[model samples]
Target: MTPAPSLAELEADCWQQLATALEQKQNRTESHGFQTMTVATCTHLGADARTVVLRQVDADRKYVWFHTDARAEKVIQLEAFPNAVLLLWDPAQQIQLRLTIEPRLHTDDHVADDHWQKLWVGGRKQYLSAHTPGSVQPAPYPGFPPELGENLPSPEESEAGRPNFAVIECRVLAVDYLRLSRAGQTRARFEYEPNERFNWLAP
Candidate 1:
């Protein structure tokens, strides 16, 4: 069997996996464990966590982003507390990544436009919601208008949702990587901001 990779090599592997996740998301083919991540944000009451699909990733810049409704509660929380934690687990590989990040919102901007333009009709359907997310309703809501049921909007129709689309871009400051194995577990920390530092940690 091959020997375990050194701390440096492990760090490189972590970044590579992040890049791969984005690629997989684009392909829309094979399933990827890293496709979704739990975003934890601070709220006045306490902490709020939600699962967001991994949207865009820039390994060189150490950033990842996902789309959301502009009216979503999480947007309010992130606006108040820009710092958040991104937790990703790859059940297939038994690896979990925790990233400390600084999030920036992009709406009515070039960044949001780019992502919205690239989004497919089915994905845009959610953005076409007539009501704000998490709003209490007299009856159950299907997110989008009932008329659009089981139907994908035309490209032109999809554009109407642009006003509600918002992108949350997260800049990764530090990464905590953990891998579970039958033999043993490996954990490490990689800090990119303030100063670059890497160290192995006890699992």
Candidate 2:
């Protein structure tokens, strides 16, 4: 295997890539960008993966965040295994970010509450559904209760789901960045094995 980059180089490159990826709001809603990340987790039997939105990225801290319904099956999987991975590919930029992370679920913490408050009324509507996430019910259901008077529930009606809405904080342990370009492709990995130490991977 090729030698990893020096500690300083690894840290600099990882932060630079992350800052560029998250700073581009254009990618947030783009077809294939930060929003379209594959979240990999472990279940009782083995590993599992699914697409999830990327809610936040803190380059300085080398961490990322995402949201999920506490009732989702993935939450159960996460509870079983705190280790997870996030895979993001930006077709527009021909770049991919593979992040190995340690996840912590924020349910009732002040952090989760802050995120919930910022959610729009329409976005908050998602958690107001009658049935739990991934539930099998007779006939199809829209998830939310049929009636909400005329508008989305005030924070009170939505408050019940606050505990149900969870924010997943992913502390990045390592990140592998692969970019495909006309001038040959480039690949590199950054490893922060120690909570405080960082190392680089050869391209």
Candidate 3:
């Protein structure tokens, strides 16, 4: 039988997986492991959960970044309550990671500008929506203008989205990792806030 991985090894492996996911291109299905994560935020009504694309991850700094329209409801929620949770699951690996984060918004700043410049026409197209996210439309809106349809905009044309593009920089306060197996399950927590804490948890 294969021996169980040590806590240290498991921790390293988890970060490696995240790093790999960040480097994967949009065409790579494996990227979904990290590309699509559930983000939970607090609002006046209650807790809101939504799936967001993971744009970047920094294991060393314990930070992650995602983009959104500045007018999105989640953006407002984050502004009111900067604390949020990011949940990522990889079915192939039978691994799950829950991240506690403090998000900072960057819209009309150099940080937003830098990220905007890196986005291709396809990536920028989503920001060109005429209506705010979650708004009621007269008939139906395909998020972006229907005229654009599947066609990618030119580099110059994509610039119109710059004003709507916003980046959320999440400072990871803690990470809870879990892996399942027929033999047994492994769980660990890594905290990096007021004081660093690391330990294995009962599975």
Candidate 4:
């Protein structure tokens, strides 16, 4: 058996997995569990949560980001309450990461521009929707023009979605990491906000 990793090694593993996901080095399903994440936001009535694709990660800054429509309900919720939780689970690893984060919206800035340039036509198609996200529709909507069903949009045509494209960047304040096992579950917390700290937690 291998020796148990030091606290620092465990933390580095977490960041490495995130970075690998951004690099797309692994197949989507086989990605180290961060290809997608669940974002929970506060609303007037209660809490709201939805799944979003993970777009980018910066281990140095401890930041991760994803894109959404400018008119998304979650965006509106984040505008009101910038604090949220991001949840990720890797079934293969039997591990979970719960991140407390402060989210910021970037609609028109170098950050947004850079991310926009990275998106391919297919990824940009949803932003071309005529209606806002979560809006009720008379009939089912493709989230884009009907004519473009199951078809990739042209680069020029996709450029029109730029105005609706928005990026949500999360400054992860703390990470609660858990690895489930029959022998024993391992858990730890890594905090970065008020001060950087790391410690094992009761699993």
Candidates 1 and 3 compared: the better one by TM-score is 1
TM-score of 3: 0.94
How does candidate 1 score on lDDT? Answer: 0.92
TM-scores for all predictions: 0.97, 0.80, 0.94, 0.96
Task: Return the clash pairs for model 2, or none.
Answer: 4-200, 5-200, 129-143, 129-144
TM-score of 4: 0.96
For residues 44-106, write the lDDT of model 3, one tens digit per residue.
988999998888878889899999999999999999998999999988888999999999999
Candidate 4, residues 1-203: lDDT per residue as tens digits? 99998889999999998887767733444456678899999999999999998888888899999889999999999999889999999888898999999999999999999999989898999998988888899998889999998999999999999999999999999999999999899999999989999999999
Q: How many residue pairs clash in each candidate?
A: 0, 4, 0, 0
By lDDT, rank the candidates, best first. 1, 4, 3, 2
The number of the candidate with the highest lDDT is 1
lDDT (C-alpha, whole model) for all candidates: 0.92, 0.77, 0.89, 0.91
Question: Which structure is stronger by lDDT: 2 or 3?
Answer: 3
Give per-residue CA lDDT, model 2, range 64-132, as digits (tens).
888888888998898888888999887777878899999998988898988898776667777877678
Of 1 and 2, the candidate ranking higher by lDDT: 1
| Candidate 4 global lDDT | 0.91
Would you list the clashing residue pairs of candidate 3? Answer: none
Residue pairs in candidate 4 whose N, alpha carbon or C atoms collide under 3 angstroms: none
RMSD in angstroms, all models?
A: 0.9, 4.4, 1.6, 1.5
Q: Measured by C-alpha RMSD in angstroms, how accurate is candidate 1?
A: 0.9
What pairs collide in candidate 1? none
